[model samples]
Target chain A: MTYTEQLNAFYKMVSDECVQGVSLDCVIFGFHDTRLKVLLLRWKGTHEWCLPGGFIYKTESVDVAAERVLRERTGLDQLFLQQFHLFGDAVRYNREDTWQRQKMPMPFESRGWPERTLSIGYYAVVDQTKVMPTADFMTDECRWWEVSDLPSLLYDHRHIVEVALQTLRLQLSWQPIGLNLMPEKFTIPELQRLYEAVLGRSLDARNFHKKIMGLHILTRLDERRTGKAHKSPYLYQFDRENYKKALISGNLSFV
Target chain B: MTYTEQLNAFYKMVSDECVQGVSLDCVIFGFHDTRLKVLLLRWKGTHEWCLPGGFIYKTESVDVAAERVLRERTGLDQLFLQQFHLFGDAVRYNREDTWQRQKMPMPFESRGWPERTLSIGYYAVVDQTKVMPTADFMTDECRWWEVSDLPSLLYDHRHIVEVALQTLRLQLSWQPIGLNLMPEKFTIPELQRLYEAVLGRSLDARNFHKKIMGLHILTRLDERRTGKAHKSPYLYQFDRENYKKALISGNLSFV
Candidate 1:
């Protein structure tokens, strides 16, 4: 579509029905190759990247809006999505120079949106291999970037990512929610590596192993046979029933 | 002041300069006599009690607005305040019969307020003895109510209080922030009771004592003396330096 057509389509989509002054930005987290990553989108006609976000419709609840945004971006449904924080800094969208630097029109301002906006930040854990991200009409590209080495994001997105990571790290301490980012079966070393990536530091392997075993949320599985490896560690799968019980009772502690 | 004069004053206070479609409801928590309580206000011309709340001004950040509201109601400043949740149900303010039943004017609608509003829930911990809650123009009275036995609240204030308590319970598992609700010198049993009040369940005394001792975030003080009591338990004060460090590093675990 032409630039005008895309802009007009975007305007038409949002102008009539969305709740004014409110938006939902999602930090979809995925674990792959021993690194934690977040999904970002590059706006059309600009190199500026931002979290996949959209305004809430007047007829829908905020939670439903978040789910809709996630489904539209990842083509996945019923994932563990959590509302973590709300960013309401008055200057969150005041960087007009950013638009000028990127050589893109200020769609929100030009189209007469609310002067001040409050965005609800949500974080989701999904299996990276299961997602096939497709750009929407207003986005030129959609891709995953390592959370540790993210680009210069638009607006307060960098801060949003930091808060999301902090929330994820806190949640990791008490709940076994990170299993959504892992495969159906995984080795102890792989699980430890994912925890290390999310916590942004290396943990003592022996202590981590002892803690995980004490929690008793993971079931031991048959050893994986990587032919080239000297010896394969035992694989494990998260015991779904026990995990849910632990989450509800606040018993799972891995930190 | 007369009812009409108070109502007019409240209308003038909120009509001209507040942000549209956004409000802040504060769940100010206090602990006294081994019970957790929340500050609530009876609205003018209505027996319905609600969390002491106000609107955010266009010129101030939401955080500042929360502090302002708390200070206005309690005459306390620099307390431990946290933004826990945003209540944004489409029907949050759709209960007109609630107003009509109380014979109170629908000031918000009569003054041309937005049809829908999103409220940010903030929880503040303060020493109950230090607070001197004064009624504002819109409030007929302001008082603290035990969380265990609260009266019918306005809007979704009940849900807001529940979320605040849940957040407090979650924070108790990781941080020593509940100290604000405790006296300067407290026994281990007193501390345990505070935790139980926040968690809404009785905890094992020996286990809780051992866990708290292992944390080493409390400085043992001299034993308290009571003429009619049995053996006195040792008193303790939170070691401020270590408490701050634990909060920053996320190491303080009490559960």
Candidate 2:
């Protein structure tokens, strides 16, 4: 009938004929209060925790499947999710604890799910404060764990997490999506702390300040860190228009 | 029969139990004589060039699928293969003009027989000199095309090639896989040209030289480019140990 209806029909047709063979694993990275975190779920059969994950229909693109998983798991709409790595070790599905062997209703699914399931790991740096975490579909619970305290995980998931962190570390050098991880307005120390957490190393306070101030990505806000500090650091908010322009041309370098 | 034979017997018992739906498409990259090149396959149906691809059996891992694809197509036994992107768009299969829809037995498998198929794209940065370019199984012919002048391709292969280029461009900063694309010993100008080709822009020769030399990944050889009229640039080879160390642990700033 209309353009929307035609578009819907196209989507329906695609899913029917495409023979989809894909799924999403979200390396949901979040920074809450001060510590950097990743969203993980205690898997169904075991005590091991893993980043939220699910299978993509035989008809969806890996990117769209990833986004769907992120939104479905976190209850965050349109969170900035990035597909970072694909875990394709042949024995990745050998474990008796994997969700794949759980008799999914989709008959042609993981039935003979390859001995190694190829999982496309997607990273989403979400605003922990803004988004409500909901674990409805297949997770026992979805909560942010300090990156440092990540427990034993299943399969090559540990490696996947490591890769996602590596990608995040690289992204931090050029793209300052850290603002999304923090509040609308954050202090200098908060910004520095987030960077240190992501980088997993200490930065020279003065140098970090100089770098941030030089980029001018942040505008000074009329507030301070408010708690116990020798000097209350000035609050800063991101300059969205400038950031978007820098991002679009792919010039979001902070280093 | 022994337990080993029992395990083998069991494996055969369930070999058909797996559900296979995934595939790997390699956007093999190379730098030949200073021009950025990509390894492409010319299918029999049309002259359209496409990445060498293969399906992951219900029993194999993604990496195995890629390696098998390489072995099946180029006769490359081993090379530096990496999975960079996964193209799972539902409509990626049904594109008109150049897809091999007739030879394939099924949309997914039906290999050897002429057919239509949807494939995932993995990228490999290989020593092109090592690839035998031997035809195997379903492929007609394989050729290395200059990345800048890639021919009309099938499906989402163009996007896959672009993604591989992006991966290489980003990886060039941390890892000196640039060496993999070059001859054993290359002059400074040769190396510079390689970077310029992949980056698709002219870098200041002096500054580029300074930065590359400073990375300490190159070992100057005891020879020079003889044909040049100007000062013969000394030959250099990448110091793999240092490059590997840097790649594994260091933070990269190059955008």
Candidate 3:
């Protein structure tokens, strides 16, 4: 069966169950115009925008739940998603009076459960162009917001975001940072913007390029951007196999 | 009303009505007699030993459940316990069965509604001398086993212990180690044994001393061990303020 069928079957099985459970929320990070932005969804009945999230089934593994959430929200599975933290505050159960409640069916509203709900926070960085993320948009709208100045989120979501950010920072130092968040083929500037968004600071362009190119995780491609001016920047794609090997060997560090 | 009453009330109320859900299993690590070991418990009416674990309450945080399990098995609450990994395999649901297949109990040996059971793993290093392990020995028997030659465990518990071991190895590179698992005041060799246990290998003793002593997280306690046959080694304890400052500054990489 297809992924959609599997999801539909899962939803059919547990739509009205009253048992205690879990959901996966993705703080999908992306780079747009040199800024790091996160994907947030508006509710159908409320105006508040929150991170993209999905409920879990009794039969599903927690890792699979995270992958499914990533797939449902972005139409992109096998992306660089991670399970960084689990948020389980008892008060977070009452969604109607909390973060989900604030979402109005306006420009930025939420369409979530009306009962006791608990969730785990899974986050990912995807190449903005690779994701067709108008997913699950009913009366609710979806859009990206800058990381530095995030709109208030529901419940302890802000705290969840903080944990994700901390995990991202630590991971960056150990793993190659930009490849997961960017497209398969991209210019050096695109890679630079992704890092800038994540690090929330500017980096010396020449030095950043020198450091990244030195790692040899990328291979220069033949293609160039179509709708651009100035010298047509050359595109480079991640050397996947070598990068995986380098990752295991600790040759990649975010710093 | 005390915590036990509140917890017992919560447990009894949810036993029939709700999915009391997760259990927290601890894979506590220790360095003893030049070997690495983990704390284990053997359930009553069973011949095998397993990780000491218990259920989480509807209202209490998962971390609290782990702490309660630690206290229940070993009578240690104030030890250094950290959330290492979460095990949520679907195969884990038939866990009680794996524990009692051979004329033990019905589920492990009877019949009941299938309940989903995921577990969170926590590990702590404590002064074993202070712990008064379970006295009744009814539900289970508790003891510490050397990690190098661990007996096959119930369900995915052995996998859970492996995860804890990996987390400990990762923590060794950056976080302050040896202190919590050791006596308040210990010699340089004590710290070395811990590093070796966690890394599962040997290191140059002089280099290990240079690396640790260079960090300066230790306070030279004016004491020495009387029972040792070798030269009287100077004892040391963690400098609380220095440790806190190191944690805040994100300088705690040890692996």
- Best candidate per DockQ, number? 1
Error of 1 at B57 (Å): 1.2
Tens-digit lDDT track of model 3 for A72-115:
77788777877776665555544456633763222111222223
Q: Model 3: per-residue lDDT, tens digit, B1-255?
A: 643454355456545443346567888776777788888766555666678777666666767667887888787777788886666665663555674532233331122333566677788877655666672333446777899898757767788888888878877777776667776777888778878877988889888888888777888877886686878888888887887776667576655
Number of the candidate with higher lDDT, 1 or 2? 1
Q: DockQ for each candidate?
A: 0.47, 0.39, 0.42
Off by over 4 Å in 2: A1-21, A43-48, A97-115, A137-140, A223-233, A249-255, B1-19, B99-119, B224-234, B249-255
* DockQ (0 to 1) for model 1: 0.47
Model 3 / residue A23 / CA error / Å:
2.2
Q: Judged by lDDT, which candidate is best?
A: 1
* Docking level of model 1: acceptable
What is the full ranking by lDDT, best candidate first?
Answer: 1, 3, 2
The digit string of per-residue lDDT tens for model 2 on B1-255 reads: 743354354334333443344446788787777788888877654566777875566656767778887877667656677877666665665533333542332332222211233355677776677777754334568889998888878777888888888887877755666756776787788878877887788888888888888878899989888876888888888898887776776554343
- Docking quality band of candidate 2, CAPRI definitions: acceptable
State which candidate has the highest TM-score: 1
In candidate 1, stretches whose alpha carbon ends up further than 4 angstroms from where it belongs are A12-15, A203-237, B1-16, B107-110, B183-193, B201-242
Q: Write the per-residue lDDT of candidate 1 for residues B113-189, one digit (tens) a residue.
A: 66677889999988888899988776779998999899988888888998899888878877877568887888889
* lDDT (C-alpha) at residue A115 in model 1: 64
